[model samples]
Target: MSGEFNLIEKYFVDQQAQRSDVVLAAGDDCALVSAPVGSLIAISTDTLVAGTHFLASANPRWVAHKALASNISDLAAMGATPAWVSFALTMPEIDEIWLAPFCEGFFALADQYGLQLIGGDTTKGPLSLTLTVQGLVPQGEALLRSGAQVGDGIYVTGLLGDSQAGLDVILDKSNATKPFASELEKRHYLSTPRTQVGEALRGIASAAIDISDGVISDLGHILKRSGVGAQVEVEQLPLSQPLLEFVGSSPQAQQYALTSGEEYELCFTVPDSREDAMWQALQDIDCQITRIGTINDDDKLRLTLDGQDLAWQLSGYDHFKTN
Candidate 1:
């Protein structure tokens, strides 16, 4: 097996997606990246374990893709433009075959966002990946969870619950034969971070967060931070065609839409004054946006279906909670 430095040099160094703001990149003690004048640096890191995050038999390419994309999603939620990333990879053994496709997946998404790989480390361990992504946003203009105000419309970008349904398919938890098996699997492994949508929402959205821990859990973040409450219309939750086909409009689908994690869609609030401007700003964004609820003064979250209260017993994914 190749040594750590040799593997790093071979797989990660001198890769594509170089940025002019990066003063120094990989192969250094530490990376040096510059933030443009009047801009603030946004940083977020995520760790993905082999069994807990992805199946042990999962493809290395998709694993790398998910690891990096999830972290970038955090930056997007802050309405930042992704600029650079540093990742640490731990493996049971240095298998060049696995390392080969992993870099392919990592750099493929990096190139898409023009992200420069600044620095990272390689170690031998229980097969895990951690990526730290950095982005730039205008000072005093970064969207935040605490900015939501009472009466602001709660909105979400793209279809929700697909990632959870895809996980069910991956784990063989789905009872019925799934016709859109590949589509669901793709949604699970290839969740797209709403970077462009986040950029469009910079000035329009009062508060924003990426839906990694399901809608209820993530939106709860905004509510808690803003010291406000929200009432989400269950009927207004967006369901993709594959998810609708998989489970129809039943409560099961609704539950998934409410509590499924790793969706990576942007859930944001728009002040009533900017509601029209918000629509116009996001009209040309690739993903669709839905107004599913409104902020309130009560400081609690409520759910309703067709103007009637809907009871939900399930909670979002929790890493330390014992069943």
Candidate 2:
């Protein structure tokens, strides 16, 4: 091992969790993986930067957890089975204390989903983590943003706004005083990718997206791609009691659900006829699935509360925007 590779193998590779799909793991020119027969590989990459993705001084373990979860969530969105991951981890300093816990967090999530750690780079730089996750889906069966249609039922897994509520606690210590504050913070930091539920959704959901960028914004991707519109019932949005206590009002709860980002829940569409199948698909997963809306003919997004159109005009999270 080169000096850098030595550092990586010691701190990362030797500690990695294993998988059945990886033919080759770390300490190689390239890692090889086997896609299951009759399955196509799905790949996605995600990056988390300090001060943006997490607080600069956030716990290293949670940072690592969120990084891996972000990529894992993408696989879930596509109805794929996660198999392997290659990490590109950059750090400003080599703190074994921090790296050890980070590795623990990374492997915890990996082991849960049977994700293998392949080969990747390690370097000294700003604190950042990028993971490329590979998953498998039966050929021609991946859920997509363009599959939604008029009369499709709109749904999301898990409650919305928790991550944003978590962010509120992180950004402002005062929020930590709220009820269930630690729970909210943990929700943002410890991502739970709905891998099983997503795989089960194949052939049942016409369109799907992981809610990384908030419901309206990410679901809008489905609307635009499928050439359809959506009408959401604000009163029907699934909000956790903790989130309700954290945000403190219907309006605030609605704003968080509609605009805040990085919750990693799946938002999907099913043809009206598949609603029962949708329920059957999720029976095995331990998640709260809620139908919030229906796909419509026109390309105009609208939300209604108490049978009246809500004139809310907030766009969801924009990565490169300044106001």
Candidate 3:
């Protein structure tokens, strides 16, 4: 095999990987994907650089997982059912020691969602991973940020600020206990996108977004698109047992709860009328969900912690700002 083809075939492609909709797989010049009639395709692309997204020495397996999961989170936000993906890897050089575990992580996560890796590219350059994910949502039924109403309740699946707490552990291992630190590290490296919750929330959630950035900032997307505002009760934001232990009850923890990002939980809005149905649907799923705020008539987004006003400042990761 040619050098490029050898690398791709060895680490990425699974010739035995089965998908009826995939007319052509990785060896082709272009991949041909088919969707069921009447279903809409949802496509999302994400790129993670070595130093920016992960430490250069970080586990290649985790690096692969994060790249794909982040894009999958985007599809989940739109209530799309994941189907296929195309990967592009740019690396300083070929090293099977890194490549082997990387593909292992990629395929493991793909199997969980029944996602197919149909095609991708491999090139020598700065170390980076880019994944393009595609999913199918029924026609006219995909959830959107513009669907939120003024009285809708703002709800989030899973805990918040764990990823940032994880980043803390990454930056300073001495800051936390070994076990607790491991928990935080796991959150930083592996974020489980709420794919099932998003799919289940269709027609139930008024608006939906994934908590990649801080909730306050991400909710702003829903507010801007839905042309409405929200009032968040900061004290009500959920934190995991590990996260609570990591920072304790303090302003610092509070800030982490409100501002840290990359949790990948689904932040959704549900109308009062659908509240019962939402509860009923969620009961069958094995996850945590919480209502932290409510939509409003005012155009301003505000927050209250322990019934006192909390200032809104310091948004989540902005590529331009971070740069």
Model 1 score (lDDT)? 0.86
* lDDT of all predictions: 0.86, 0.85, 0.83
Shift of residue 161 alpha carbon in model 3, Å: 0.8
User: What are the per-residue Cα lDDT tens digits for candidate 3 across 113-172?
Assistant: 878888777788888888899999999879898999989999998888888888887777
Candidate 1, residues 167-259, lDDT tens digits: the string is 877777453377576688778889899899888888999999999888999999999999999999999998887887786666778788998
Which of candidates 1 and 3 reaches a greater TM-score? 1
Q: Which candidate, 2 or 3, has the higher lDDT?
A: 2
lDDT of 2: 0.85
Candidate numbers, best TM-score first, in rank order: 2, 1, 3
- Give the TM-score comparing model 2 with the true structure, all chains together: 0.95
Choose 1 or 3, whichever is better by lDDT: 1
Candidates in order: C-alpha RMSD to true structure: 2.2, 2.0, 2.2
- Across residues 123-163, which tens digit of lDDT does each residue of candidate 2 receive? 88898878999999999889999999899999998889888
